[model samples]
Target: MNRTKILYSAAAFIAFSFLAGVTLQHATAEFVPEWVKNTAKWYGEGKTSEVEFVNAIKYLIENNIIVLELDQKKTESKTSPTFENIIIPNGNSKVGNVGFYIPLNLEIEKGTTVVWINDDNIEHTVQSQDEKGNLISLFNSDLLRTGERFAHKFNDDGAYHYFCTIHPWRVGVVTVS
Candidate 1:
């Protein structure tokens, strides 16, 4: 009830609340991708197409690579969308294809959905497997025709390896954090 005691208690409460608010506000951890600089340079030099450049920018923004502290309404900040996808290119079925799926290895945050679109002119399946070439039964997709996509939402932190049952050599990985 004394003036000094009351003042000290109020200060301590305010400090504790401030620290808690800071922690809550930073719940989403953001990181910068190392390839962004090189990609930007390539775009500036006309090596990369406009669509590719735009897609890179969207990937950065949506994935929180470029964090923008916007002081606006709550819903306004959530407008940026998440677009994570892998493309099974036309010649993906071929054995020893270096780039069977565009960016054969992907790193994403938890709760992110990754889609593998079959751009090839053949049927394929996305079957999850262990690193030792054994099926782990995590995710399995039906036969995907050309233009069909198989999507999986990763909710945990681990490396998920998948391959096409028809073409086992066609393998890719999604690492979630």
Candidate 2:
């Protein structure tokens, strides 16, 4: 083949490969992946701030669309006690649909420490209460920001109801047995 034709073919192949890679990178979840890609693009174009870019990535990771690898040795703590974790997902502010705490109902054994992790961009509170709206002093997290965590040990056997003060509609229950 002619040198010019060969060069053109090579360029086309490179362009196709680049486009394919980009397409695959943003092909996971329907709306979230696209939103993440656009957020990154906007950040690169200076249309968005660094905070927004980082938050978008966090959202993606929290939603399981993206998985990050961390040094397990550094993250592991020998003194840390293992607890049952519940995630306060993003979009919990919404009235219906996917806006609520994951595993609305949880059951754990007595002496188990229940940990609530805030995976949303907005702040949330893990306030323990009863069915009649009476507050429980056993455990109450005032305000948890994104990536923050709150934990409480269930020493007794009973049903503990909790809710987010910011969005009372987002409620959950933990039964200790």
Candidate 3:
């Protein structure tokens, strides 16, 4: 090839490599909370839970809200960790009980596992499905034994609607992005 053509081709290659590196660096610049970092690593290692797993996203975000308040702590980065929680209480109006009618709003990324704990002295099952009341996966234990727990992992990317089959009065929704 001619000397000028060769030099032009080499310059083009160098420019492409530089641009690729810049793009990759920008992608990883997103900030992921340490809790989520640990959770992802642990989940990848096959750990499971029915309570804290889903709440990790919420925990990290809530704590970060305080950190980001400081000018030095905030970053121009845009990546965020998603977490949430929902507690289902037993039916039969025991009145004055906490977690009853308490709706938890959460935003979680895809592949997060949500754990549901039955703190009531009754049995409850965590079932997921569409809005039409279809059957999804059923995770439950006998009366939850008043401190029993149930957990499920969500790998898909979308919203998952869930409810308690045993108690039709119980209903909840989870959105996985």
TM-score of each: 0.54, 0.52, 0.43
Note the clash tally of each candidate. Answer: 0, 0, 4
What's the CA error at residue 163 for candidate 1, in Å? 0.4
Local accuracy of candidate 1 as per-residue lDDT tens digits, 1-177: 445434433343333335434221221212434354445446666677756655655565577644544445675767454569999889899886664788799999888889999989989899999989897789999899999999888989999999998898888989999
Q: Least lDDT summed over 10 consecutive residues: which range in candidate 2?
A: 20-29
lDDT of 1: 0.72
Model 1 scores worst on lDDT over the 10 consecutive residues at 21-30
Cα displacement (angstroms), candidate 1, residue 169, comes to: 1.3
Choose 1 or 3, whichever is better by TM-score: 1
* lDDT (10s digit) by residue, model 2, range 1-177: 445434433343334345434222332444355565666656666688868766775676577665444445666754465489999888877787586677788889877898899998889999988888667776899699999999999888888999887788777999988
Residue pairs in clash, model 3 = 50-115, 57-82, 57-83, 58-83
Which segments of candidate 2 are over 4 A away from where they belong?
A: 1-81
Sort every candidate by lDDT, greatest first.
2, 1, 3
lDDT-wise, the better of 2 and 3 is: 2
Alpha-carbon lDDT, every model: 0.72, 0.72, 0.51
